[model samples]
Target: MLKIGIIGYGTIGEDVVQAIGKDREGGIQVTSILVRDRSKYVVPSSLADLMTEQEAVFFANDFDIVVESAGHGAVKLYGEKVLAHGADLIVVSVGAFADEALQKRLMQKATERCRKIIIPSAAIGGLDRIAAGSLGPMEEVTLITRKPPKAWYGTLIEQQVSLTELTEPYCAFDGVARDSARLFPESVNVSAALSLAGIGFDRTKVKVFVDPHITSNTHEIEARGKFGQIMLQIQNTPSARNPKTGYIVAMSVMKTLRDRASHFVIGV
Candidate 1:
């Protein structure tokens, strides 16, 4: 069996473990979890033997891979350590890569240690074509994200405008991916992923919208380059336990792990 370690015990992490446990293929299992408060959260019976981040690093040396579903802070805290231990790390919080210095450091460590870092297509699609076009003379890339008004409640948009009073769709912010990540850290993973796949953060345009009519979070990408013009959109349901995160984000993480363990892989 392929042993896996999870960096967070939040909704995405719990969902990944549950899906793996329910899969009858019997090839992958979550061996350990790296959580800040193991006692505060009730871990599933299957993963009762959870470990702290430090302990997880010790186990990562033996595990097949480590999945980081934790927030950006956790990624910055333990990413290099996991890679230096010779374990592949799948990071769901790709938005953290907007920090150029941290991204360079992580890449350097991974390269030096001959380890791999995986980024899943979270809540967005058509990344393969985008990445391919990046090899050519790409000119522009844009990301537009739409979510329910309540989704932007605690964000800077909430402080700027009343989400409850918005009767129509309102574009809250427009800037580059680096600025977008800083402005909307919890909601800009797709943008960050696209930025990393196609162009650097400064060149990727981002627009955030709050829609009163939309029930689910929506993401759209438009790109123009020498290769051609590509447009893609995805509407994702929010996780029942965590409204800020899309349900498809968790499913994407599972797909990434499955592909890693499977001999026959589909799509890059």
Candidate 2:
């Protein structure tokens, strides 16, 4: 069985573990989970014996892979240590890669240990073509994300734009992928993933909108290059616990974990 260590037992991490538990015979199990405050959460029976402090994950030899479903802070804190210790790191918080130095350090550590820092397609698609286009000449790659105004309540958008007064959709941000990912870490994981696969962060365009007309989180990706134009739109349900994260994001993590244990892989 594949032993998995998870960083942060937040909404995404808990969902990932619950999905794993549903299929106990999938050959992957959560061996250890690290959270900011363990006392606040009631972990499932499966992880009751394996829960530990965030630092403990670095020293433990029990897990083969570490899934980072934590936020950017957690990734910065434990990412390099986890990879340096010889465990493959599955990064769900791809937005954290916006820190160029941190990204380089984690890549260096993984390379040194012969481990991998895996980035999964969380809530968007067409990355295979985009990644291939990177080898050729790519002209443009734009990611436009839309969510309900309520989702922007506590974010920067709220301070700049009045979500309550807006009756229609309004574009809240327009910038490069790096800034978008850093500014909206919780909601824009797909931006970083798309940027990493298709182009560098600086070149990737990003637009974020708060829509009173829409309820679910929507992502529209447009890429034009030597590989021709590829456009993908995915309307994902908002995660019950986290409005910033779409429901499909957690499922994507589960799919990535499944692919790790499966003998026959489907997509790239």
- TM-scores, all models, native as reference: 0.95, 0.96
Query: In candidate 1, what are the lDDT values of residues 1-268, reduced to their tens digit?
Result: 7888888878898888888888777688777788887776765565675556466454644777889888899789889988887788899998899899999999999999888999998888988999999999999999999999877766788887888789999988889999888788787788899999998799999999988998999988999999999988889998778777888887888888888778988988
Where model 2 places Cα greater than 4 Å from the true spot, the runs are none
Question: Relative to the unseen true structure, what is the C-alpha lDDT of residue 232 in candidate 1, on a scale of 0 to 100?
Answer: 83
Q: Best candidate per TM-score, number?
A: 2
Candidate 2 structure quality by residue, lDDT tens digits, 65-106 = 899988898889889888877789989989999999999999
Clashing residue pair totals per candidate (backbone < 3 A): 0, 0
